[model samples]
Target: MKLEFHCWKCAKGTPGRRVTAPFNDSSVYRFECAQGHVYEIVLAQLRFEVLAETGMQALVDGYYRDAVASFAAALERVYQLYCEIVALSRDIDETVFKSTWKLVASQSERQLGMFIGLYMLENGDVPPQLPKKFVEFRNKVIHQGLFPAENDAVDFGQAVVNLVQPLLNSMMPRYTQEIEAFMIRHFENAEGAGRSDRNKHRVFFDFILQFDTEADDWDPAPADLSAELVARRSREIAD
Candidate 1:
């Protein structure tokens, strides 16, 4: 089905049309602008495009793609949590929840990204190509609106979903174990998933380090952060 809408970035009239890409089978979408920049919107969510034309990809993403967003957000929170526990935990600061909660919420976004990325790797639809600088820009959004906007996120999200369909079916038994196997599949010349400790965390760490320089705060906690007191309190308030 052809989706009619304006280009999210250019505000020019464009439609979700398809053309063959060099590496993949499915026809990836070509979102064009009158000026020049074209967005290859792969996983075509008609609903999102409609809203995006109306200038609401951010809102739509928050609703539909909350998990991916929350993953990054959660890590940012854990960063603060770690810093706080390490330094400020001694002082009972009431304003501690500001950035911490936002970061915790980002955990879901990370999970969603992992889920989709792994899924794409399993299938042959798209390669496992994540843009590092793009994420770095999002981190900057904390200070200024200088980062690349939600369109890139939408494009990446779509590509991930598209690529995972095939792999999702074949790579069930060795899910995490197989991330390495397929890492080379997408990143042909690049390093595949390294089994060793320092190696495995590159992609994981790369995702987080884009915004903040700290490494993954993944500790063998007794419970998950989402399952801990913070989540419980949030739930209580919601209830």
Candidate 2:
């Protein structure tokens, strides 16, 4: 099958050529661009990379990647990545932001699951839920050594049509919109928003002030906030 995808390096949308690589049923895709930036992807590695760079995941054949991380550890990693994505976007609908996000498109369950986790955490809306057969089919695509029946896989494709949106809504409340608005208001359109790299920290700082508990009910009247909290917030925004 053929699909259209963009290169991470050059931002050129190339028609992707997929070959069933070695490892037979493993289903690995080697995506290359004319400019020669190639991504050799399977299921798990793609998930880590997608979230690290784009706040999303790359799925292959209805498969997604996950690891059992302690809640605190996961929180630290995810939150840090979220802050970085926000800082890079600078309140703009930057190309990198759009190209990397996985809005649960077909054949990319990894992307969908990552979106689900975040959307759920943030109280976003989800579409319908896939039928149990489809869930099993998608799960088989992710975990090796789990061969689901071909009929189940086909059933999954059909049932997913209704459930995805509801599942998505169950997670985050207009998750994309709220974050996009944050980017536009402070980074893209804010006056005096300089383009210097150093000033980038200011954007994250502002983001933290907008969302973090440290800033909740902040008394701007008394010195605008305690000096210690200010220092802590500053350090967080920097790191």
Candidate 3:
């Protein structure tokens, strides 16, 4: 995955350096323009959102296997985020939480188990499980190296969207404070890492599946890959 941004120093009536950076685990991205101006941009979108966007792009480009892998990864990352938010609610120390996460970090099955347990405990309701068909599809694509067709890839992406959207809506209202706290910590870490008097810091938040709690009537588009692609491309043209 990659992100493109215009350089801050060269943004007048002239064209600015359009810097592109590969998306890694870190939210802070540093870029130096052709004119030697440096920038530190902290991406505010969570990891899951970025992964989902990458999956969508892959699907659009006909990389079906890569699409499935990225969508599956997005689901796992959201599970981790859910666990982290739950821990934050309980006033858990970040260090201890990181240590606990290490036990399951390398194993996605263990992470899923953690998320299920936490959701049940917090919500007092059974969390939604990935349908068996989707599970088999994911296992085939990820473990057995199956190259899915475009329709199958779209179905898998839709399944992920169906599962994640409700979870996001629920979490937004129930854990608003915790979510805000997490974002604050995220920006603080990014700023601290890239701290410099000479460098300008900027925060960017552009998630494909974002929810606006403040909006009175904001219905998300249906979980259709084709519709999503059209809408995304439309937005790109507008920008």
Q: Compute the lDDT for candidate 2.
A: 0.34
Q: How many residue pairs clash in each candidate?
A: 26, 31, 0
Worst 10 residues of 3 by lDDT: 213-222
On residues 186-213, what C-alpha lDDT tens digit does candidate 2 reach at each position? 3334333333332222212121112222
Give lDDT tens digits, candidate 1, residues 1-239.
12332444553334333222221222233444555555543322212122222222232433324333433343333323333322232343535634544454456454444444533543446533336653564455433544443455444333333332222323323332333332333343223322222221112211111111122432211222222324434654773
Please report how far candidate 2 places residue 30 from its true position, in Å. 14
Model 3 earns a TM-score of: 0.84
Q: After superposition, how far is residue 44 of candidate 2 from its true place, in Å?
A: 22
Assess the local accuracy of residue 15 in candidate 1 as a C-alpha lDDT between 0 and 100. 39
In candidate 1, position 100 carries an lDDT of 47
Comparing 1 with 3 on lDDT, the higher-scoring candidate is 3
Give RMSD (Å) of candidate 3 vs. truth: 3.1
Each prediction's TM-score versus the true structure:
0.21, 0.24, 0.84
Better of 1 and 2 by TM-score: 2
**Candidate 1 local distance difference test against the native:** 0.34
- Report the lDDT tens digits of candidate 3 across residue range 1-239: 56777775696544447777888777778887777777777777778888987898787667889889999999998899999989999999999999999999999899999999999999899998789999999999999989899899989998898888878877887888898889888767766775566444655545556654444534464367778777776876775
